[model samples]
Target: MPATLPRLSVGETVRVAVGVLAPMLAQGVIIRRPGVVSLADSLDTNRHACRILGDLRERYGAGPVLLRLPVRELAVVLDPDDVATLLDGSPRPFTPANREKVTALRHFEPMGVLISGEERRALRRPWNEDVLDHRESLHRLHDHIVAVVAEELEGLLPSDAPVLTWDRFTPVFWRIVRRVVLGDAARDDEAITDLMVALRAQANWAFLRPRSTRRLRELGRRLRTYVADADPQSIAGVVARTPGVPGTAELGQIPQWLFAFDAAGIATYRALALLTGHPAAMAEVRQEDLPTHRGLRPLARATVLESLRLWPTTLTILRDGVEETHWSGGTAAPGTGFAIISTFFHRDRSRLPWADEFEPAIWDDGRAEISRALVPFSAGPAQCPGRTLVLDVTSELLAGIVSQFDVAAAPPVRIRSERAMPRTLAHNRLRFHLARRAAG
Candidate 1:
């Protein structure tokens, strides 16, 4: 057991620095354990773990309970209001430090702006300007996503089988989006895959293989080169461009920035595939009142929320405390890191109606009950800029898939890596027998 610190008085700071690690035990601080978290310990397939956490939240009263995962660890099991509290202000106020260490280790870049005070506001604006600012471009992007999905799913049809392999479906979905968004440059480019693979390997290492840190940096460079080479005029250039907003582009941190996306994007893509790849989830698409006025949008927002809730890309969003703060019985001294877990919070079945079920009807009342607890893309100044684009595009792509193909679940197969976030298939062989839907 770690040493216990007496209950912290207001104004006392939980000081943690490099080479000096102290965990905030419910009781007190302890020296962090050796092998604290290995590559294997890094999250890959989170389904069962998440369920267990949910169970614990219910037993522990459902908000802000910390866990000791074989180490004196700090984790905030959160809800929407907690999420709002943590994420609401610029440079999110309640962001945690340990998670930030992990994040910084992966990407040398200041992508921490997502949680870093001051940078949070600046970083978010450009993302909005480029991806979400213009309605037309954003909609066009969604249409492109829809078109590609239609083409791919259309080829899955006229079959008798009703099973979908998340493995296969995920790659196809990513490939289509990569092609559409990055253009034909990525079509034959093996480097994109290499970039993803290498980055995943690094993220899997976490604290276990600090040696892998250098390798990850190298991979990031290679990836940046590839992207730059792919379309000097577009994708890479835009990312390289300073967002005019101060501190938005800590470009010197390119390698880290790229890796951040690698870790976050892969998980997000996997979660999306799992939700859309399921038969029951897609059933909503057959409904009469679709978002496009022709196809179904039944669980569009619900699906996005649930998937993100179930398998949040990042375990928590970290913020550096700018000023002394008090929230829900906890005091955050200035300079402390605040970690908020939307994943744990979103799964609080007690806070949600029919929370254990997959029914979308509960949120479809138009008031969106789920929104009350939702924070998949987060909220506040650091709320994800790519969020709108992701939702719009994913929904459109899902609509196209259900509209064109008879997607269904497939038998699971063995894979080597389980620690990869977004938990991509090790074999990458998710098989699906495609059949044309009647509507098509």
Candidate 2:
């Protein structure tokens, strides 16, 4: 058994020191380098970095083990069993509020039911009700998007063979997502565009400097200013008041969560584009699964799970120890920051067994049990409240596209590069050939 690791504070320098020591203790593992797990201070190389680790997990058991990432941070994981304990345990021992370093603040205000926990529960049912609870609604929305995709592809594709890439694919899909979320009326509004642009810019900055809490805070303030200036109202607000939305005391937090909402719209969806279009995965779906949009939800969920496993957008899950803790025979003082890379945890293909194949079939049966390692949308009480809604949206959209059009790989998607972090593609481009599908 290894000795107890030292207790460290939450500051930057201390975090770096942890990075240095982690490698020695973790041995020649991939998690040793912070770059392997961090989305900051590198050339957005974490994707490629995880690919390297993917090579390792392909060899090693994807069980509780140490790894080295490109950035400089220490990681400790207790395999899938331990992960379940962390995620599904009572009181969830490790709460999001405990670790400001890792909690995503850009989606919805941390106020109201989200922060209170009660509001989170209340909002969860309704949001899913409006989105997922109504299966017919999801199908109708999916069919609409699929039809639009066929039309868009017709406009974009020449009457010749073309390669579809992220640049062409993502924008068309983004529009589809917007229509689903806000309805067609809100799709082309400049206000939405400006809001998304600002949110993306802030995420780009966060990716470049994960430890710059102050910078993120400033970005939050700027976002608040944007909202204040725009005086935006929620589309849901049109449907119902955000009863559990943040209170006046928590009004300051609205922009941060709002930013997260916008960020997920693109970041997660872009990942969807990349995964679905990967040559191997694309061929199967286009040829085989395209006929039946039946598995769209399961397939899309599997896709996001795989992508999150490989290129975790949040990168790491941060936890503050409730007490002197023991993990994998090592201990940390209470309050010490404990981070586990979802990138490593998710890619441990052994967990998914069929991970390398990209066959969405593995997730088709709702009854098929999966290892607890998959947490793209996160887990426990603080788990993404909108998980069902997002999954429904992405799955239906992908299914709709594949069922309607013969999407071909185009040029590599173009993105706006952040200096150290990976660039956000200028667009998710793809060339398209219309598919001849029987009426649904």
Candidate 3:
């Protein structure tokens, strides 16, 4: 056990947080002692670990939680200020070295820029920079996504049947991304969808090297073949044409684009649900004739940003301290690793007065500082470059949905929030019912 700290009020929160993390304890094993627990069992996955960290933040203020495994030590930090410090000093003092990317994804994307150091980050720049430049072109795919969502809402789910939000949105969302990035042909490609489905499943136990590796390898092969001569404007084209740094695999950066589909869908669905929960907000969104969402019309943007605040796609981000770092009046030793649960700070009343409330007004006027702190895309050099495009696509798709029909929880939806992390473990399943508008 680690040395106990003086009984601060945060102690209770730490206890609760640890209790919450119990279910995820995988059956760890030791080589000498038959059934001894290992650090492998300490974290079910990075996402699961972050959920626990979020709990720590809620239970304790923005501080560190010390966990002393048999031979190793771990610290989970929940402070946003620390997060800024950690991420701002990326690739050196703070680095992304997780079980999933370093282990399972190695075979497929050995040089994956997603969790790479500064060099790989720069090598992968073209793909992301291209997306940033051509976001408008990608935004044009909003109509197709709306059509896809509309069809799901109108044709699939009705008074008689309802679909789980996770089940419903993931395929549609990924499909939209495929259509926009790959090409219009990908919109209806079953092969691509099947591959994506397998990969999505792989995302959970990827560190364990599940059956999904076959699929991931298959995806890498497909990208290598199909993307070789892709249109320069298409996402696949940019990825294919991107010059790989020395000693990196050809298709290294594809996973970064592919994984984003999952996060984007989660945030967008929550935004829709928030809109449904607040009819006035939905109405305001519908009335706005916003062309592009560079900075979305306040109400629509707020709904999205507010939803992100409530349910950030990334539950926690892990960074290893390579050098002694100082932040929020403390020093973390070099080699100490920390996971920041930004959701905790986003919801902390001490930081934002209306932390528990969904208020778009906070994002308005001159409060970009508060909005700046709400980092669902994360912070610093590795922050998601594709955020603006995702938001634009979300705003337009929501507008299209409202234009077609009035959507709501059919028998009244209920959202539960007792989890370590938010968003991904969405509480509402039988989601959004639609009634065809009485002719606008």
Please report the candidate that would top lDDT against the real structure: 3
Model 3, span 1-440: residue lDDT tens: 33332122455445534543332222211001112222322332334544555555566555565554333334666565666766777777777654333553454455666666667666665556554443343443344444454554443334555433545545566656666667555656658656655555444355564455567678877776657756454566655666655645546566556656556665677777777767777888878754664335557666777777776556556677767765543556676666565555576655666776667777676553544456767767767767666666666556656666777764435433322223222423437776667776
Residues 65-163 of candidate 2 have per-residue lDDT tens digits of 332333432345536666665666423455444334323333223342333333343544344334233334243344454454444544333446345
Residue 105's lDDT in candidate 3? 44
The lDDT, on a scale of 0 to 1, for candidate 1 is 0.45
Q: What is the C-alpha RMSD of each candidate to the true structure, in Å?
A: 8.7, 9.1, 7.2
The global C-alpha lDDT for each of the candidates, from Candidate 1 onward, is 0.45, 0.44, 0.57
The regions of model 2 sitting more than 4 angstroms off are: 1-3, 6-75, 101-165, 203-242, 245-301, 322-324, 349-355, 365-368, 411-440
On TM-score, the candidate that comes out on top is 3
* Arranged by TM-score, best first: 3, 1, 2
When summed lDDT is taken over every stretch of 10 residues in candidate 3, the lowest stretch is 27-36
TM-scores, each model vs. reference = 0.65, 0.59, 0.75
lDDT of 1 by residue, 300-346 (tens): 54564555555454544555655666655454446555555444455
